[model samples]
Target chain A: MSTDHLDGNAAAGALREIFTTDLTAATGTCASCGNVATVAQAVLYTNAPGLVGRCPGCEAVLFRLVRGPGRAWLDLRGVTCLEFALPDPS
Target chain B: MATVSRGFFGRRRSGDPDLPPGQYLVTDFPVLSAGPTPRLRTEDWEFTITTETGEKHAWDWAALMALPAQTPTVDLHCVTKWSKLGTSWRGVSLDTLFEDVESAAEYALVHSYGGYTTNLPLQDLLDGQAWIAYEFEGEPLEPEHGGPARLLVPHLYLWKSAKWVRGIQLLHDDEPGFWETAGYHNYGDPWREQRYWGD
Candidate 1:
């Protein structure tokens, strides 16, 4: 049997380099299947050429982060929209 | 070139001939799926091959199990830069499954139970190249590893091996699948390092 690797939450460390806020908790809708789920639920394949986040509902790639030589490429075509929850000021 | 972290050593095995370019050797088989692992029973399982002309070939679990099974030990190379060597699997060859099916289709779109699809050339799947594997490492395949049956094309990137494979749709024209449309190479050959589009 294959080992179960980490989910989208594991990509948070790499994603922090790009986004200002944490993306794991953000809710997004899949453009392919229209299923809404938190980014944490997205399947993540990391340590590759880049970080790949796929929708849990439809299995469509939701986002990709590729770091090149002094450059970064971000593709979010598979996501229809992302809704972020603002932090509560306590 | 991207700068490497100080004292950073990749997980590459020393002098492993089976390891491909830009890939590190790993002993553990990693499970990479797009969604929840599908649990399917053998009694409810069926394999189908459909051609562009609407011709179809079907096989139940028992019929498939009764076929001549071959256990081949092969290396698996994932587009994710991980190559696992000497992995053993048992399955009926695609050649046997496609024995009597007559079609001039140049391409094939493999469909899975989870609605996942991957495309490949017809030639890539023939001539003792691929299989519908249901047993791995002398054990019944697990759902996370594409249990019941999954297409095992060890030559290409592992993503091309669609898990929970249910049917195959032969096409005269090439059609990009999930990852192919998203940005992956249409034909993911690890030997050539064709990981993304225009590689």
Candidate 2:
């Protein structure tokens, strides 16, 4: 199948269900490719069992999500680590 | 069979027996895809079904159009919790395609033009349960919605109804598809709430 994919921002809404901050702006490294980039740069594929985010460098899956009536599942096996920012103290 | 939509303005009436568990009603058909949509021209498109022994049954646009088509009205339950009921579709039945095909295979791996694959029990595709739908609600299906033709198997979760369908490879053993391998339920049955690996 010749497929197209959107960037991680396309999945920000669905991800908001779990994250308190902008996970899209957080830097993450792909477990397979070691490419470190903000989640927004990740290629996202919507329209399946859930939203999938892949690495731009290797096309390896970085995250997977599946939602139900009252529950949601997010898999980040392809992501090695994620770095999020905290608000500055006054 | 009354129409129900939980729109931005109103709430849905709980306990609607028609919908499977964990599903909500949607008046609008939501577009979801694992990748970008494939634009397939009918003239260049062909469908194939390969038996376990490598016997190929192929049909091009013209050959497919010549077959007797059926209109099916069915409900669609998505793993994302959206369910659309009483949708109409026009296409050739899988029964006609598999009528004379010889295969002892119990499973089928459906391939799509976009490199997407979804597998299911072969029996789920026959006996009027499936179709290669070319039209939806009296209109030619558009590319994003799996135009040209898409597998229409309303009995299972919509994911099993592969979009941008290309062919089927009959297999003796069960095969996990794109989503299935990506932590999705191997056999996605919406009614059973099988949305993930264990559920």
lDDT of each: 0.85, 0.86
Interface DockQ of each model: 0.10, 0.22
lDDT of 1 by residue, A1-90 (tens): 556887788998656744777778889999999999998998886643467788777677788776544555677888888888765545
Q: Candidate 2, residues B126-169: lDDT per residue as tens digits?
A: 99899999999999998878999999999899988888899999
Relative to the real complex, the DockQ score for model 1 comes to 0.10
TM-score of 2: 0.75
Q: Candidate 2 — which pairs collide?
A: A1-B113, A1-B114, A1-B115, A2-B114, A4-B36, A46-B33, A47-B32, A47-B33
> Which sections of candidate 2 miss by over 4 Å?
A1-40, A54-90, B1-15
Cα lDDT tens digits for candidate 1, B9-117: 3466677678888887666787777655789999999999998899999999999999999998999998767678899999999999999899999999999997778
Candidate that would win on DockQ = 2
- Which window of ten consecutive residues has the lowest lDDT sum in model 2 chain B? B1-10
Error of 2 at A78 (Å): 8.8
